[model samples]
Target: MFKVEAIADSYDQRVVDVDTGVYLEWLVTGSRYTTEVFNLVHPGGMIPFTTSREYGVDPHTGLPFLVFRFITFGSAVRAQLRTKHLINCTFTDDLAKKFWMTVAAEALVVFGSAYNGFKVPNRRYTRVEVNEKIYTLEDFGYTTSPG
Candidate 1:
């Protein structure tokens, strides 16, 4: 398992609530990346944001954060990854690229040309039996260095 970490805004100040300022920062960052990534997708669609996002709570722990769901298609594969939990994050430059790359890889995995219409042939990936269905970047070969 990889220890994935990202810095996020606290949205607090000494006197007045700085939520607006923090949100605005995310908005600006999100807008910039939205355009850049959209260009890369080119005729594809996306709705990623630096700060603007749909909020949800963890079913078990009730931890809340912004969510950006990505469904990607690569030349050989197509897969979707949800649950890149951006908790008070500004969609930092590094992580935004990471997210984009991760989804692209997943799409390749799902496409199965690499695996030849099956799982990775060498058993490099291990499948687990879980009641809930979710795709992890690790399964598609993404690991984060410690912060």
Candidate 2:
């Protein structure tokens, strides 16, 4: 039998409005929103995940827009579960993958209530499915743009 669990360890969001010069950033650890997300997605599981939003003047064009980024950790465990636990009917790897995939697909729907005017980027935004190494804001060049 494969016993699986996933939990949201942290939650964060940043919103920058180039038009109005408004900037917002916040961090919530084990908060109701985080718990709610975990319940909606993984239920009884515990996992590490990241959600981010960027908005401001486009670095390349000086235009205003919004971008969303998502990442998940624990590829080794996810992979092992997928390969070793394919049978026995206790737990399946697909469930693990599905949890993260659902988060990536529906994060905005689940957490976008705070941002009133920010919309998902029309162009293709960056997405890392399973990151072996976590990233920093500098890695994404988030600190360079106007708020």
Best by lDDT: 2
Off by over 4 Å in 1: 1-37, 41-52, 70-136
Say which candidate scores most in TM-score: 2
Report lDDT per candidate.
0.28, 0.33
Q: Candidate 2, residues 70-100: lDDT per residue as tens digits?
A: 4333222232333442111123587766644
lDDT of model 1 at position 68: 31
The Cα error of candidate 1 at residue 17, in Å, is: 39
TM-score of every model? 0.23, 0.29
Q: For residues 61-112, write the lDDT of model 1, one tens digit per residue.
A: 5554223333321111111122232221233486665654444334322322
List runs of model 2 lying over 4 Å from the truth. 1-41, 56-64, 74-95, 113-147
**Model 2, poorest ten-residue lDDT window?**
34-43
